[model samples]
Target: MSFKRVFKQFSGSTLPRFFGSDKEVDEFSQKYQYDPKEKLGEGQFAKVYKAYGKDDGLEYAVKVVDKRSLSNLDREGLKLEIQVLEEVDHPNIVKLHETFEMKGKIILVLELVKGGELFDRIVAKESYSERDAASVIQKVAAALKYCHERKIVHRDLKPENLLLVSETDDTSVKLADFGFAAFCHDELDDGCGTLVYVAPEILRGRKYRTSPDMWSLGVITYILLCGYPPFFDTDQEALSKKIIKGKYKFRQEDWQNISEDAKDFIRGLLKRDPEARMTAEDVLEHPWISNLAAVPDLPLSTMQKELREFLAKERMRKALGAVIAINRLRNTLNAFAFNDVDGDDDGDDDGEEGEEVREEDI
Candidate 1:
């Protein structure tokens, strides 16, 4: 894995065509069309290079994939990926400008986004501030919504898959790394998606749905606020167990300054049971995400007892319900211990005739 910082300041007067079907321009050689500049990044899938249109001077990201490197991969997988990309079109998703084969290597020309991988930013900065975190996730949510609407599930939605292509002006949170992307109607590979971020159902090798994408989003959200994955462990077996078990922690030290709504969002999406997890639409309507200003604070009452109560006993969520229930019950008096006769005045026990009372006292 590698990273690059792109600034989308296009000086081109004409609106750029997002996708071009014209792969063969016999009038222009492949190298004549795009001037490949600096190497943007390298990955198992392909090497990203900064390219500029020789005649148009427009910037682009060209992914170079040498067939020799991927000896194990087949042509059908490539076709599926291209088909998936063609079917998906969203602002947050990396735009496929063009594709062409040359020199026994396939090239994917895309919009050059330079913000680097989102995970890199979080790790480099230790953690994302509340506003920054909000901005990042909003773009992700938009991308996922677009994919889900088209019946395309990005099976692998790790942070590295998210790219930032700008620093100041042409800013965007574009989704990249679509090698594992597949259609919901397609047969799934048991070992698909990243292990650390894969949903529990996928780990169990079961037939699942789009919930895994939500699970990955939850993991990304957790990492954004807390600086690391929620259920991560070093040992492969242990990590696998934790992921399959869907165990998570909301340590105050780790989650300080983060909003209650944010936590709630993570908890619901990361639930062990796929059915219990929130859908893409539900996430869009969630308080924290829907209202940018609705992020919770500690001093305020929102993250206080009511919020805690909501968490503890909220009908639809299971994240911090246990702790909230305990805290909520603390305010409770536990009246189960009180005898009803002590407070009853409708009819006194002494007023009851034939009541067997004086037998056992010695």
Candidate 2:
């Protein structure tokens, strides 16, 4: 697959009239006032702005997608994101208030999360601990459990994607960015995710499903406790090799004060064999999360410093060229075939089916 296809970054030739009939653009204009100057974030094909409801006067994040810039594949991916966002309803998940199909663009009205990303929030904390980390992971795992029960895989899970709903509410976590999410009706073939958090199965070009997401969560959980990724390398090849080998350690310097339960939790999720990996339900019931009250409150001062340094490097890397890295990895993988003899078992127990709720109800 091409880099754009694998990265799902919406880089391709323009496509006109992809949304069929245009819904009245005034539907959004009449209800919300969006100022382009109040831009919150931007991606390859979309820009999000801080908006205000005309009557309710509530703040919102309005994501504007330039449909004319998307290819057919990009359009399909956007539709899938919208569908998944519409179907999910959970306290820890970001809310989509409504959608508008304009003449040349599509707009999504989403809940405006005032708090920053996960690591940043923790770094600002006066005292960080395993208890605090568990609290954050519990929220993420709860959201994932809800999604997995519905056969929806987030595909991408990382510190940047985890958001705090309020600037003052540390516990108000929300899982944001469904751009790479999909319903796992069968084994998923696409290997679309950031380089660091991607599962080994995806890097090997193997068919996978929810277990990949669990692996991602495992990586995130490791970073949460230690303030650095379990696997790290500046070179893409070296990094992928480390991940594929599934060999990471809890270094003595950083892990000396950490609890065994937390380490065990990470091991369970980071298993190389998908069948041996822990499910989202298992995450919820793990002693680290289940017995959170008993978790040590020893301050992770060194961890906070490491987190700050990690965040700085992350920003620099993004500015320099995350897209370039993806292209390089894609080119490297094109020459090889990583077919496994094992059958296509997703290695997750299906949870009870939940009722599908519309955005309005959520």
Candidate 3:
């Protein structure tokens, strides 16, 4: 629920810092001018603003992270993201122009994507078709294939991370956000990623690789055709259990109008075994993706209805999760305070010893 919690769960060891060790803050400050009024968004660690290059007059999105606000782990994760972004170059993947450090803030200059999230465009459409979804998926697959070839795995691949180049360009879906991405030569054992989109192997705590990305793509594909995720539960643990078991159905009501070829493609990607799952290249070659024009345009009113309901429910779940996390934190703090008072009153030499005695007495 919390960004810090997500980072703690996913982040690995620190790599060499991406920026030059000897570069001074003033040097970067002199190279670019940021427009204070043109703000994009803010996260826990950083704020993104629209900026322009003084020399070339090119527009860019600059993410500014306050060094003082970040932990060592947070810094490591940010550096790793930058490292991954620097190596990747594809039309479907958001480009990183450059990175700089200035006055205790790490600034990442990224390509400015005008059009919003991929889901926003789909939701805005009056008549959605399998062919439309396939076209979008094709672009995403191309991006993934490029990354996989370079040994980079985007651990987080959901609709939210997929963005369009422009409102009119339905085919130009660019994959954004590399915070949870990793480069691996062998299987990785880290349990990380968003809950519903995560692969079965990762949920089971088994070693996994780029195959999980394909699994996430399948989930996205499922949602593209329908409105909701394949695996859904109000409870996180229950949802995780479903994912680990790979227990999901097409629900006759939802799939009755959808094409069989689309379903087969999804099944191939969502296979329980990573080895059995389709690779990015394989997905690009799948009939549904390779020949989108042939896919039927079945009415998706039912899917649209379900998606609206799912979005509402997802918002509620996130709100509930935040409240629960806050309450748990408050309770722990209260208990710690109570223990501190009891320990002080008991005339104990060691605070931990008195706390243990109080806990046992309770």
Candidate 4:
């Protein structure tokens, strides 16, 4: 099926109440002059379209979000994202041009990044080296330093969130998505972020700060130099346990070609103690990142092939998880509707039971 059709069906199935009136949607379309033919991507809460401004004819990625589909926590997360995006100003970060609200939906006008994901670009290359990996990490570190200095913690940092400006522009790695970001002062005791990228401290249910992001960067750097993540597990519980223990290695087969300085850099960032982890500024000053020219060019065909397979499996896993989540949401909504129709007052018990399920699953 076409991406547009698939997204339409997914949105309709997952969020029936979020669909605005035809008149409201028409007004929004007229205001932005968005071409429905130019779909960029779709996510759990929004659909992105490649739009052109009528005033200047400049291209933009317009994200349409359904407020009615969001829970109270989800709404708060959106607000936090907007706040962070508005405050951040860095060359390596995606820009948010403007935002508008109509009916029960919010529209965000974002910078259109022509280049695809960073890892996908690397995998497409015929040859990848430690120097090439250093260049990417340097840019990512700069972006993280910029955000960290501003007291913003990007709670979620993964390869998929890193994008290049264009295929030819290797240096222009832009950090995208602030959906899970929050202020440094915010209490972050809840377990959040992608499973593999989550830090040891977070996995242990400890109150975390910005160091978790550094740990995630370490994981990305590890994959960049090699093909696969340092830690891997099919089961979530087992993965969390592994992460908490900080059990990872630079296997002889992979590390034989990789430099000691590179391994040291990863070690500093992936330290089990958040206090011991290196900051973004420290990463920028690391010898491996500061001196990239001396790094060796190694044949990474094996790594590339492994990365491609890992990414394919990860995509399937996420798709399955999304389907499961949608089904649960549908069941919850149906139960609420039934209760309302039957004039039932057992909502308190149902809500408590739902909370228990979330605690166990999450």
Candidate 5:
């Protein structure tokens, strides 16, 4: 029922480090001019909190990692995430505002993604229209392409890791959570990444060049369009087996109505060999996405059925925020149907994303 039982044998491998990296920022880091205002979420060693910047109106999600957890060697992983995040200036990737060592802990001041995780939206709708799904896929593909070109690999790519700023439909996909990520130039000694999203070669402990993220993107695209993942295991061992074999059938109800190009795209991404699978550039250029208008769009419901989506998400976010705040949150999320990530607001080719992450290689 957990990641432990599923990859227990691999536990002696590098898998454990992936999940263990979320260190509590409170341990050694202290916010200057910013105090934790709201607790957003908690991981094994870290807690994401909303903080207000001193002298600035901007709000940031401060990721606090306990210094005690980061051994001399582990500091490199933390450094890897920070350095890579700052260096990768892509619209789809989350923006890193600032990172500094406070006391002994490391504090990562990042963009406060208000809309939360994409999984919430996916689970709420139970499925997505192809057009909408394609848009999300395209944005992610672009980001992955940027990362791949730089020899960076986002080992973890899943709905939960995909943080959002607005939920305005097809416009809100921002790739977030780079904690388990690693560089392509570095040794692939660590089989680090989420279990469900890990590509087959990664699980088998084989050397892979790239395309693991594409496999994850494929899984995300399929789930967005079909309401559930292609694989599931009440037990981790079974899940691993399912992952290695792709042991599931596409139902007539899901696949019949969906486009064949989309299916082919997913199949290409799900290739077992990392070398054989479609690249991020190839995915972005795929007919399913590039030729989106060519495909027949699904019909929209005009009745009370149309209202169901709003009602469902409203119900879901109620417990998470105040009534008025939640309503505003809903509208803002809806606006993400067209949020600008490549906004050259400052006129520099390196946008607010590049500026926000000051310590990047760029």
Candidate 6:
């Protein structure tokens, strides 16, 4: 499915502008260099490529957004994302080095993280344990705590957005993707975020703040300890109903060997009431996270097995999506050709999504 976001900009906003004549950087080609390497990733309105600074020679990821393609609200969302990235600096969060405003596009230079996604990395591990899961959550929770202190809420928190710094270092997980993030200064009721990880209050159309993010974190934690998601169904409505009801269970097969502290941690995060859900600060102090020694090192073969199946399905889904994108592009081209032949008015229709986008890629 296509990812969508909406942002309503107001006067007297706190975000800093990346464009305008006052800014020093206006030309992207003069500051950095790239090989036009095969596209690292893509999104609805942008494409990502590997680039390096001209002076420092350090590697970076450059996200190029076509201004002509963005709607008014999309541009506002992009501006907010840039402002939030500029406001925060943490080891576990992806860093935005600088930005450039070209003639028809805006370019954002970001930290180049080569490590794969969180679940993909975990499935490859020879041995996994509660301690390992705790380590991953600890870093994510710490990063969230940093953002929440500034009143920023990351509306989307899923395994795809969590990435390791390098293939060899699994402990150094970084939180990527801020497309749905927003400042939680007032009550929000926008229906955004991926379906499975979405919080109950959002689906119920209730006003909320940062609590939804914690619920997503809880779902990720559950997936990390087990292989599959807590809530699942063939139908979207059915799955959403389960999430709204907070309907989930820790099967004995997945939890028989898992520690009680770990289970308790999940329970704390998955609470139905937003107020009852654990905050990022509370998560940092939980025994499962604070007391690492208490966590077990037992091999999580069940998780690994389930993860393999889950990953396989994910691959298939992506492949199908790519095929669909290609077919749509072909159809659009064919339509243009027909219009050109018939000379039936000037046809100007460009489908929104152009590339196969991944969470960390953007």
Pitting candidate 1 against candidate 5, the one with the higher lDDT is 5
lDDT of 3 by residue, 1-362 (tens): 11232234444475333333344455556667887789988888889898888888888888988877877778777867987888889999999887775556677889989888887777676767778888889999999999999999999898778988987876688999999999888888676778778886666556777988998998999888878777766555655555554546776677788898998888888776688789999999999988877888665877777666666666676666632322232233333322322222221112111111001111
Q: State every prediction's TM-score relative to the real structure.
A: 0.70, 0.86, 0.81, 0.80, 0.71, 0.82
lDDT at residue 270 of model 2 (Cα atoms)? 77
lDDT of 3 at 91: 95
Q: How high is the lDDT of residue 163 in model 6?
A: 83
Candidate 1 lDDT, tens digit per residue, 1-362? 00110113222333222222344334235443543457888866578888777677788887877755554344445655776776777889998766665445667778888777665544444223565666677778888888888778888898668888675422257898777788886545344776667776665555675778988988777766655566644334545555654556765554556777777778778776677778788888887778877564233222232223322232233243322221132123123212232343222112112222111110
Q: Best-fitting candidate, measured by TM-score?
A: 2
Residues forming the 10-long window of minimal summed lDDT in candidate 3:
353-362
Report, for every candidate in turn, its global Cα lDDT versus the true structure: 0.60, 0.79, 0.74, 0.74, 0.62, 0.76
Model 5: per-residue Cα lDDT over 147-249, one tens digit each: 8888888888977777666766544678888877777875473566665566755655556656678888977776666655565543344455446554345
Q: Is candidate 2 or candidate 6 better by TM-score?
A: 2
Q: Considering summed lDDT, which 10 consecutive residues are worst modelled in model 4?
A: 351-360
TM-score of 2: 0.86
The backbone clash count of each candidate, in order, is 5, 0, 0, 0, 13, 0
Q: At residue 25, what lDDT does model 6 achieve?
A: 42
Deviation (Å) of 186 in candidate 5: 5.2
Model 6 lDDT tens row, 46-117? 999999888888999989898778877777788778878877899999998887665566778889999979
The true-versus-predicted C-alpha distance at residue 49 of model 3, in Å, is 1.1
| Clashing residue pairs found in predicted model 1 | 6-114, 113-165, 114-165, 115-164, 115-165
Candidate 6 lDDT score relative to the true structure: 0.76
